[model samples]
Target chain A: MHEMGIALEIHRVCREAVAGRGPGRIEKVRVAVGELSAIEPDLLRFAWEAVTRETTDEGAALEIEWHRTEQVCPSCGPVPDRAPGTWLRLCPSCGGPLELRGGTELEVLDLVFAAEDDPPGPGGDEPGEESA
Target chain B: MSSDERDGRRVTRDFVRIRKSALAANDRVAGELRDRFRDAGTLVLNLVSAPGSGKTTLLEQTVRRLRDELSLGVLEGDVATELDAERIRALGVPARQIVTGGACHLESRIVRRALEEAEFPPLDILFIENVGNLVCPTSYDLGEDFKVALVSVPEGDDKPFKYPGIFRRALIAVVTKVDLLPHFSFDLDRVRERVATLNPAARFVAVSSTTGEGVDAWCDLLREALAAKREGRPWP
Candidate 1:
């Protein structure tokens, strides 16, 4: 599925953030997946593990926070928050058509790495290591 | 660090958790595509629908009809086959087929390349006939000015309600193959009402490419969208 692509993006972002930190292994990478984004978190996590297996971030934990798109009823205002994976048609409070508000987001937030204390950087590669 | 007193197997560090969205990169790419379309004066329409929704047929007829009035370029997306592209080219419009190579939907990256391969020409409209899928394409932004979702009569009157995500995201809902209504059990009003509920602002145009029915109004809608872009106004 498209989760591979999304996992690739997550890998790209994590790589950029932890680049040149000196052979340090990534601990976890946090990503937010919106309900309307058409991305399945389980598949994305599976893809992440497969993608990062040979990379520096191997065995890294992928923390996915699922976000829901708020569907506000024009007549009733905001719909009540329900458990994840629940679908609602009509407004529970008022019988009004629901309007989607948000939750179609997919973003890589931050990267946590185990930066080894080796006199400044990872393996002492200070900024510009070996060219080529 | 009162680990032993807390009766814990191992004291896990209380790391600060930050919640964020992952679509920032996609949004960035989408933003750039929007700018490029604006600069090129390209009105990109991402046509989405289920299989057999008459997307390619509509493009073929539209290209043939508006060949004299505007410069048209078509980007047809499918898992395999250049047949749609061939059909468009047979109409003499600048068209290219993007075989998604098993992808269910066309992402924005493919479209960005298609625009580049088209020489980034100054065009009136760029029709991106997305992979004939109702579910997947609704989530992916193909860098289009607006999305047009097709619901054919053969699909059933409950199509809109069953797949609200696509219709809700689309700006225009085109009910195609209306000529088949006589033989099909389709309620036009119920479909229209469902679509209206999802996207109240979206406009609906019912047409039949086979019978040449209601095409003028559809063509008029297309003209109005382009004209709105030309006048620096919001497209209807």
Candidate 2:
């Protein structure tokens, strides 16, 4: 799946986002994947697990905020959605052509990082850094 | 280790907000390349389609039709083999084959690499024939003036409807092998309607590379794009 490449790119974005933040575990990354972006969320999450498996971000959660590209009939304006991906062939209100609006988003919104006040350890501070 | 929230030894959790494109780097490179192409007076077209959709044949015919009038080049992307490049080279156009080694899409950086390494004499039009696949290629921008999605008659007309991602992204939707329309159940009108519903701005062009039918219109569109590029105008 191309989502593998996209996941690598997302990881790169995540790295850049948390760059120079000192030693820390990136606990989570939040991103918005649009319906029209052509990225499969499940596939991306699967790929993320692979990319971040042994890295600092291992077991990091990828929260996907899905967005829909709603279709708008040019003449009638903002038509309500019938389904997420399916579009009405023609404008229900107006006979004009239906155009899509703003759903091609593929962005990294934010991330959660847990910085170590002491030093780098075997595991993260959450799971096992403070072991028994 | 954290012994409650008492000491400074506690783990500090911070939420960092870095809102940016997943392809911010690729987008930056693509923007730079677009400027470069604009300054050099070249119309770059990223042709994307399913494999065996007559992209190579269409490119060959496109070159033959306008080669004398335009200095054209092709950066052919394939998952493997130089076969597509070889085919284009037979038509006397400078074709650089970019073997992605199983990468589904040609990223902007790869195009940048191809541009740096390859020598194409001041091209009027450079067609980056993307590795055959609709889904992945739709995500990566290779600094093309526009993307063209092609689907052959044999592939069925519902392809535009099926793959709305590519259809929505493409400025032009081409239906190849209309000559085979008699043999297939593909409906051109339905394709147009479906594509219009998804991408109202996507101009549809039906062509048959075998019959040379509608090739002129396709070349005309290219010429129009070239004129637009030179005039610093948008494609009409």
Candidate 3:
């Protein structure tokens, strides 16, 4: 599936970010997948695991935030009653053309990585210096 | 401290926000291709449709009709095969076949490579017949002036609703193989209505490549699109 290609892209993005931070291992990757996009979250996660296996980012969590397309009617503004995965061509109330808004997103949102000093282990009781 | 003790120390987890599109590389290449096409004054059309939708047949008819009036080039994409490219070349036009191996869709980078390899000449219009798929190809932009989606009568009238993502982004919707309409229970009006709902701005046309029915009208539409591009205007 094309999900493999998407996963590779995500891995590349994460690898670049990780490289910039010096020695580190990726902890998690968050991505936004839109309803209109062709990617399936489960398949993407599977592909990510396959791509990251035996790599520096092995065991990294893949988080997907689902983005739903907003359906709006020319006459009624936003249609709240429209069901998910279903399209309404016309407004149910006033019989006007319905429009879709903002559902093409496919981007890597953020990445969490453990620096070299911070090994994978339990947290210390004392809070360390916080960096944003 | 030993290595185990060091592992227990508070490790910092960095959060880096990198909001970038997965297809950013492809998009960048597509933008460059768009500039090149504009400079060449070429009106490029990216044709997408399901397999067996008669995209090649329609293109053959188009090449036959417009070869004398305008210069044309075709970049045919397939997973593995040069048959379609050969068909276009048989018409005496410059055609290149991009064998994508196992890739489902064609990216702008490969398209740029194919154009370079083919030594494509400056033309009035260029047609890119995408890999015959409705899903994967919709996401990749090939730097075309506009996209045209084709659906034959046998593909059923519900294709627009079933694959709204592609239909919604297409500038033109062509219903191919109209000659088979009498043999099959295909409702052209219903398909038009569905496609209209998906993409209100798309121009709809029905043609039979075999019988040459509505072929002139399709050619006229392409000519108009080419003229609009030359004048720096939008197509109807």
Best by lDDT: 2
Q: What is the lDDT of residue B186 in candidate 1?
A: 94
Tell me the deviation in Å of residue B32 in model 1: 3.3
Writing each residue's lDDT as its tens digit, candidate 3 over A1-132 gives 688888988899778767767766788999999877867789999999999999988999999999887878877798886677667777888988877787788999998877766444456444465544
Q: Backbone clashes in each candidate structure, one number apiece?
A: 7, 0, 1
Candidate 1 lDDT over residue span B1-236, tens digit each: 01111221222222223343344466567779988888878788999999999999988778878989998889999999999999998888888889999988888778878767766346799999999888778777777899999989988988876776787789899999999999998989878877876677889989999988888788889999998987899966
**Local accuracy of candidate 1 as per-residue lDDT tens digits, A40-91:** 7788889999989888778999988777777688887877766554445678
- Interface RMSD of every predicted model, in angstroms: 11.2, 6.2, 5.2
Work out the TM-score per prediction.
0.82, 0.93, 0.92
Residue B82 lDDT in model 1? 91
Q: Where does candidate 1 stray beyond 4 Å?
A: A81-97, A119-132, B1-29
Q: Give the local distance difference test score of model 3.
A: 0.87
* Global lDDT of each candidate: 0.78, 0.87, 0.87
Best by TM-score: 2
Which pairs clash in the backbone of model 1?
A: A22-A122, A106-B22, A106-B23, A107-B21, A107-B22, A107-B23, A108-B22
What docking grade does candidate 1 earn? incorrect
